[model samples]
Target: MGLAKQQEQKILYISPLSLGDVEFQERNLGLPVRAVNQEEFIERVFGHFKGHLCVFLKRADGTPSNTFYKHSEKERMYKYLQTTFGINTYVSYSTFYQKVKKHKSDILRTQSNIVHTYMLVQDLDYYKFGMTDAECLQKIGQMVAKGELICPTFIVSTGQGYQLIWLLEPFKNIAGYTNDLDWRRIQDHMYEQLKELNSDSVVKNPSAVTRLPGSRHNKTKNLVYGFLANEVTFTLQDFLWFYDIVPVADRSVKPKKLNKKKATVTTIVKNWNEYTLNKQREEDIFIFVNVQNERGKSYIGIRNWLALVLRFHALVSSDNDTEYAEKRVKELCEIMDMSETDEEEILRRSLPAETYYKQWIEDTWDRNKYLRGGLFYTNSRMLELMDAKEDYYIQWKMKTIKIKNAKYEAARKRFEKYGEEEADKHTWEAFQERRNEKLASDKADKLWQLEEALDRHPEWTNKQLMEHLGWSLRTIQNYKKKLHK
Candidate 1:
């Protein structure tokens, strides 16, 4: 028969734990052998004979020792296998010890007994067949190209001493294990090889490799590429680059609908023109009287006077002779400080040529023209000035609230000193006295000044008169009524 097909040879190796040198009593010979600590001895003994034993060694009761051992001892043992036996030996540590303990018997039974070692060695040899530096680098580069290892991974070295390094991305994982060694050497070699491979082509292209599509990546090409043609020098450019790369989602933005209701510009302009014409007529009536008094002219310009009169009546008539017209006329008379005769003259000039004062009055009063819209058809500027006055009044009212509150508080305190009935009687008498005093003082100090203004500017209309006196229409009217009375 052809030489018995050599049974596929398999080897089992086990490492002893906590061994020491001992002198045997019977042989009087010093022998260095494998011994395990008492705690580990049971597991080690079972590991040796559990597998087919081509060779085996055991040491018992060798020396008193703890788990700690010298590095020299470990190295010496490792050296024995590598140098004398031409075998690679891996020293088992705590991690390997735990692994062996879990599968104690299975490892021993399946393996051949060629190696002269215990159960621990058989278990640890499984991981000892690790990849070399070159093989490890190749795997890391492949992982990076596939985008499997974008983050850092670790590597360990068994030569010289136990060392570890963390491999970062870009240069691949092998750069980590290089420690202090120059990795640029490896990089240079790789670059040269890549260049040689592309030498035949005018346009050098990267080799095809699988990678997840980055936000900046072109999926159409299976090659590495850069977003920038050159390096960025400015800080703003870096920000712009990052911003451009960020993905933006589409969203619907609707335009807002405006009011778009056109204002009544034509109506406003027409009303404004009419208001100006009426105001001019009022001014002419005042001016004509002033001229007559100053020049000692007995006769008036009838046409000019009648024209002014018609304009005034038209304005008053258009307002339907509303209550506001009466009020405005009263304010005008008070502001202008005109005598009854002077008022009569102005009204006469404003009336129709055929109509007498009595009939005009009857017609105006009967038709209730003064009770209609009144001066509502006035200029927008006048309305704006009125609105400003209203705002000032509101502000004054707000200010008065604080003053009133303080006065009330003081009154309350004063009243508390007297009985409630006596306090009410005294407070009312005092309030009346204070009011009379204030009224009298206000007329002398403020109303006199307004009167002087009216006397000096007899030609002014109500609005113009109020402006000259720097007073409100209401204030001027009140003072005029008091002065006339």
Candidate 2:
């Protein structure tokens, strides 16, 4: 990870229930601030909005704790939280209770995995001689590269301190996950490793939650934002580094070096020409927009979201899958871990799939184009909006939730005065303007990239260059003629 993305706004959640209330605690991010789940919390941690979300409450002794309440009791917990205080529902970093196995006396022990790996965004209160944020980051970089320590996936500047969020790519790096008890052991191992570097012991427990990026620090009066979403995502080796895992080196990543005078492939994007319905280009555009691969990422609700995206494509392109889209969508969703009843019941047939699709496509692909997001960035952006993270069925407002587009103008406009009348009225207009600019900018970016490629390999023909750059011969000719002039 190069640099972790910072807080989207300057705001911290304040607990509604005081010490007397059942769910009240000293300091919680007032429950789910910006994250739909753990990954979003890690990616775009900060949001300024306030909502009633339940974080894991601590024990009476003030010790950090993680408790896996039963599925049947979740509704009861929700009602309790809400009736006592004005909270919406429970939002947790951990997974829903899953049965691991049966024990003696026919008892079932239910446990859920910690879905998101974390970095304590701490201000080093324990140490008298504390390091600056920059120094801490530098020291971490040095430590990881030494072939000794597990590298952090990203770093966040909390305004008060820094958070080195741990890396769990493809969601499998941290294995041997059985239940909450197992996770506590894992957390303890990690805490022990980082303790030498001044990791705070108080919040190191498995169930602890941090504020989203935009949440304000009441004490410091400062806001946190993305310090960096590291360009260097962790490998199995990095995770293994924690367990003292060895012998097998993780897959090597070739460094993508950019030319000093020109932008790199990471910065260049395809020009938005036209999306002609049913044409090969349309099909390609659909695939390009929807199916971009995000290497080494496995998050919750993946299959359901894919079904939604693919179903939208089927519905829009009547010639394709129009006959059995509903049936097929259920099938696809099932393959991705959803139950048949869930596909039918949870995903209501009467739901506005079209409006949802348009909203999603516009918010995501449109946002990505404007940000000049490349493949990985674009895919990551898409992941943030699926299912619960999406705004289609917005039950409660969040701090930051627009995938990776939180940094762009399209996202910023909504946040300017978020819940205000102006934000509501002007949001759509601003979005369309940004989309139009992206359409123009992408074409320009493409041409610029083409020219840089041509300049480096002068002897190459237009056809060869077209093959190299995945451009059409006509497009290449048009650009060449324009460049020649």
Candidate 3:
């Protein structure tokens, strides 16, 4: 689904009680190393959320256990956790409750079972990288001052590391709503934005738990406490700006120069362009490489290989919709002429290894996996893998394979007309050089268009420019900085 463009930030209407007593008490608070007790911190962070809450705690027998309780029973839950010394506690941000399903009461916490997520979390563990707490805090301060990072609503000190919380107006997680995808995009963007802060990548899952504020750190024996940064709360749209941004290709966001003692934080962005293929591209490649009509010479063991490919795509494309995914996988298997036995085998394999499958899918994030550090196979390598004939290229829909074929045709024509010397200009290296030149030209044209729009409407506000030119507020600010300078 296409994400809605964010032209401006929108603040939710926060009630006085929703602001909590922590914000009231800390009206004059600064970003100092202050901490609050268990009760106050928990209420301030989770008071707005409704229904049953899920938490992980250490039992008296030293076994780790997770439990769900009604919001009114929170006091009892807290008592249970506090009874055990050095007991670590963790909490999930997704709001859930007990429901009667199939004549049994169950505590549901799956992605679909969640009503809404009241906050997004960033697990910042600087100590893992040998940085002290004070050093990490100072770097965060510098980043905020330079407008390089968004100030989190609150910060939790987990004895060894920190958890940054961005409270949001409860965003619905229903199937029909677009919030689920937008929420994922926003969370992923935040992870990328704060990678320099050693943000934990795996904590972005909706039902994933992190250290609970006011809980004890098992190893350090220090109490985990939270402090107020501000009373700021956001709606889903407030974070729309980040979702619409595309990371600059093969380039790092260089901060302004500073001396040794005051160096700016260097942002080394992963050029996703070089590392990952989009969902459409991956699906097209899978079909072109594996699908066959009659299954003759390539028919030997092709059924097993096709089943694996289909299962992989189902896991990635289903968006946690298990029932739909199951049905879709069966339909696809049938279309590919796989027997019912093959279909059942694929589902059986998938059921036992959902977690491991997710890990395998993420392995594409590894920069050293494929050609030029891409997550998927290159067109030439794909062709090599399938032993594809020239006919396969003619039937392909995605541009990657078609572009490869075009280059081959171009080179053949050039060599026929003007010998090997002129054909050298159409080689891969020369092709890349020409592509880079075109990209640069397009960037210049965009900047020129922005400048021209500003000249025609000198009195226009940022909002007006956004509405007129269809650029994000951040994009407009960036262009203004460059054009004025």
Q: Name the candidate that leads on lDDT.
A: 3
Is candidate 1 or 3 superior in lDDT?
Answer: 3
Q: Which stretches of candidate 3 lie over 4 Å from their true place?
A: 1-34, 58-62, 99-107, 175-177, 242-485
Could you tell me which 10 consecutive residues in candidate 1 have the lowest summed lDDT? Answer: 3-12
The 10-residue segment of model 3 with minimum total lDDT is 1-10
User: Against the hidden reference, what TM-scores do the models get?
Assistant: 0.14, 0.29, 0.44
Model 2 agreement with the true structure over 1-485: per-residue lDDT tens digits:
22111111111112122322212111221121111222344333312212112344333355542334443444564454344232111123333223333544431211123333323233233233465554555555555445344444334445466555543332311232222223344455556666656776644443345443434444455654433323344322223223422112111211232122322222112422111221222232223223222222222223333444455444544433444446546555443433223666525531344553344334443331122211112322332332233331121222122233443444445645564345644566777998999988987898798889978999999889988999899988888887778
lDDT of 3 by residue, 396-418 (tens): 43334333457556655666676
Runs in model 2 deviating more than 4 A are 1-93, 97-127, 170-190, 202-204, 232-238, 241-243, 246-485
Ranking by lDDT: 3, 2, 1
Residues 243-325, candidate 1: write the lDDT tens digits: 12111111111112222343332312233243344444354334533444454543221322323333443443333343433
TM-score of 1: 0.14
Error of 2 at 6 (Å): 24
Predict model 3's lDDT versus the native: 0.57
